[model samples]
Target: MGRNRKWIQICILLAVVILGGWTIASSVLDKTEIPKVGSKAPEFTLTGLDGKTHQLSDYKGKTVVVNFWATYCPPCREEMPDIQKQAAKWADKDVVVLGVNVAESKVTAKNFVDQLGVTFPILLDSKDKIRREYGVLNYPTTVFVKPDGKIAVIKEGLMDEAYLDRTIASVAAAGNGNK
Candidate 1:
């Protein structure tokens, strides 16, 4: 009877340990949701491909598209051309498109940009500080900031050219109206 009781106690203790561990693990592994529209976009300063520093607040009077991406992400690669095209179209306007590469080396990002023929500014987040500040849980996440420095839109995953164009136009229009 004593041996049986000891075994039962051990089993209960093991079950509690397992259950507690699972609970903690699940919470830690859960991905956080990216910020939503109408929120103040997190400010950051990162080095662009031209070796110049770009700050989110620097484009205060203009609309900005801040895209978080990486070289290894398929979705990020898919949206590169679209972002490049949009940047070209809005080059003369009061608009800036910043492609922030998260946790990747300068050489890797440069190679990817050259291969893809992308002309837009690709900023480097070497320490992933901006990623954590923005709660970027997925690659190819884009946040559209209005001229007022508030987030106007948040797009996750891959976005096509048409969608980006429309979003840019809308944001530009809004900025113009607010001016």
Candidate 2:
């Protein structure tokens, strides 16, 4: 009975070490540093749902909102309508909302956007390279870039219309007094 108890304790110890090691490794690997505010927005050229190529550099003089999302994320679904509203509200104001679908099929993204009536340009990050470039570790991350092409805000998780408007206003007021 003593020998069996000793073996059980050894097994428990092994399990703890393995679990601890995995936790440490996962945290280290999963952490991709998000871009600092005020840093130059990383340049990316992605194909929109419209099949037209959209480049971040092309929208240089506009307030750009880049939102990274996946179809399976519940928070992403909840925030879609608000983002659509903001997109329309700021459409004439030179503020462009770019919906970047991370690692989701075009069909899935298209259907999801269509259901939400999202009019903003939907860009496909098929390879998830752009997500990595932005260091987005969470779904529904929104990076607001100024007209001068610098990141003004990095919001993780759900972003509401009020926050969207506020960030846009904040970015517009920053760097050379851009609208």
Candidate 3:
């Protein structure tokens, strides 16, 4: 009985050690160093669902909402409609919303966009190069870029329409003042 109890204790200790190590590794992998606010936004060129190349410099004189998302992320899906609504609100303004789909096929991204009925442009990052450039470790990360091509804000997870609108407004205000 004593030998059996000792064996069980050893097994439990080994299991705990293994589980703890996995948890630490998982956290480390998910950890990302997001760009600081007011820093110049990283430049990247990706192909859009429309088959046209899109470079960050294309919208140099506009405030852009660059969002990194995936089809499987629930929070990303949840914020799609809000983002669409905000896009329409800022349509006449110098604001553009670019949805960057990370590591997904054109077909999958097209299906998702069709299902959502979104009018905004969805760019495909099949190689995850753009995502890596932006340092996105989360499913739904957003970066607000100013007219000068600098990052104004980096929001992780789902963002509300009100907050998005406020960020756009702030960027627009700053852009106008710079003129």
Candidate 4:
């Protein structure tokens, strides 16, 4: 009986070790790390509301603002005008703003943008692929990609006009140095 008990304990201990190792390995392998500053932003191809396909690689020489938002998010809605203003402000400066609507239908996104008078191209993430790729679990997340195809900043909340202006300027400056 004592030997049988010892063998059972050993088997349980071995099982625990194996399971623990598997858990750690799986977490390390499947971890979704947010793009770090100076890392290349994850590339994605999404269809904009205008029925045009927009790909990150297509805007190679431009600084890109990739903002992930949902129509139901109040902060995201509040920042639309400022984002539109920023898009216009940098239009001539080789900057592009890409608003990605998270898991929302085209009509919903279009209606919200139209109501806010936002003119920037809005992409539809029907499957939430881009949102997961960028590790954006919150609304109003903005990722700034410099002209060199590197991420400059990852902001996860509402951005005021001043913050947007300064962020764009900083990215522009970084791009200038790279050029």
Candidate 5:
């Protein structure tokens, strides 16, 4: 009886270890699953402030700039104007910058847009589905998608004009091949 009980205890311990290992491993794998430099950018559909439906797939064959932001993020506020300018600068280049408002109300986002004078489409992620789909954890995160819908760059934090220009140019110039 003693040996049987000991074997059962051992089995329980082994099960616990396996479960723990699986938990840790799955979390690590999930973290790595966030789209990388060469991965296919995840597709999403969200409504824009223009009362139009915008889907990432809709912009295929054009270089896309998916900018995740909120009105309250200071760096986002700082970089807003530059994004607006770049959108205009690169419009003829077949590049489009999409401002994905991170769960902000239309009133608040519209206020910021009005103040900043940005003409780009402001897609509202009211439920933050788009942000979570892209694994965006921070404000001012920019996902530069290549013409073929693969990610060219994933930049987090404020971006100056130079960084935006360089990244957009690189992605626009780079085809569906390696980044």
Candidate 6:
């Protein structure tokens, strides 16, 4: 009986260790496994407020800014104007700003955009499918894609006009490098 009890304890301890190791490994992998800066940005197709579907692949050869935001998020609301301004700054260039609204209704997103006077395309991610694909866990996450479809940067949180301009400039510089 004593030997049996000891064996059972050993088995339980081994199971705990194995489970703990797997949990830790998975979390570490998630943290370090974000999309690479120079790798191809993940492609997604979502409908905009105008009822037109927009695909990332469609914007190939154009520098695209994919910003994942929600209408109710304060930081997301704050950064919308800056994103709009930055997009306008590069209007003549081959650049497009896409604002992806995560898990928000079209009516809400449309109202918010109209209220803010946003001129850029606002894509709807009603189910948050695209948001999950982009690994955007925070509000106002911005992913800058270079003209070659490669990712230039992924910024998480509220972005000011200066930061957005700097990031756009970096993408432009990266685009020049590819040429």
Task: List lDDT for all candidates, in order.
Answer: 0.90, 0.90, 0.90, 0.93, 0.91, 0.89
Which model is ahead, 2 or 4, in terms of TM-score? 4
Can you tell me which runs of candidate 5 are displaced by over 4 Å? 1-32, 176-179
Question: Between 1 and 3, whose TM-score is larger?
Answer: 3
Candidate 5 structure quality by residue, lDDT tens digits, 27-143: 987774777888999988899999999999998899999999999899999999999999999998889999999888999999999999999999999998878878999898999
Candidate 5 CA-lDDT value: 0.91
Inter-residue clash pairs, candidate 6: none
Candidate 2 segments whose C-alpha is farther than 4 A from its true place: 1-34, 175-179
The sequence of per-residue lDDT tens digits that candidate 4 reaches over residues 104-173 is 8889999999999999999999999989888888888999999989999999899999999999999989
Measured by TM-score, the strongest candidate is 4
lDDT tens per residue, model 1, 108-168: 9999999999888889999998888888889889999999998998888999999999998
For all predictions, the C-alpha RMSD in Å is 9.8, 11.6, 12.3, 6.9, 6.0, 7.5
Model 2, poorest ten-residue lDDT window? 170-179
| lDDT of residue 115 for candidate 2 | 91
Q: Candidate 3 lDDT, tens digit per residue, 77-178? A: 999999999999998898999999999888989999889988888999999987887888998999999899888888999998998888889988998788
Indicate whether candidate 1 or candidate 6 has the larger TM-score: 6
| C-alpha-based local distance difference test score of model 6 | 0.89
What is candidate 1's local distance difference test score? 0.90
In model 1, the Cα lDDT at residue 64 comes to: 96
lDDT by residue (tens digit), candidate 2, 82-142 = 9889889889888889999998899999999999898899999999999999998999899
On TM-score, who's better, 2 or 6?
6
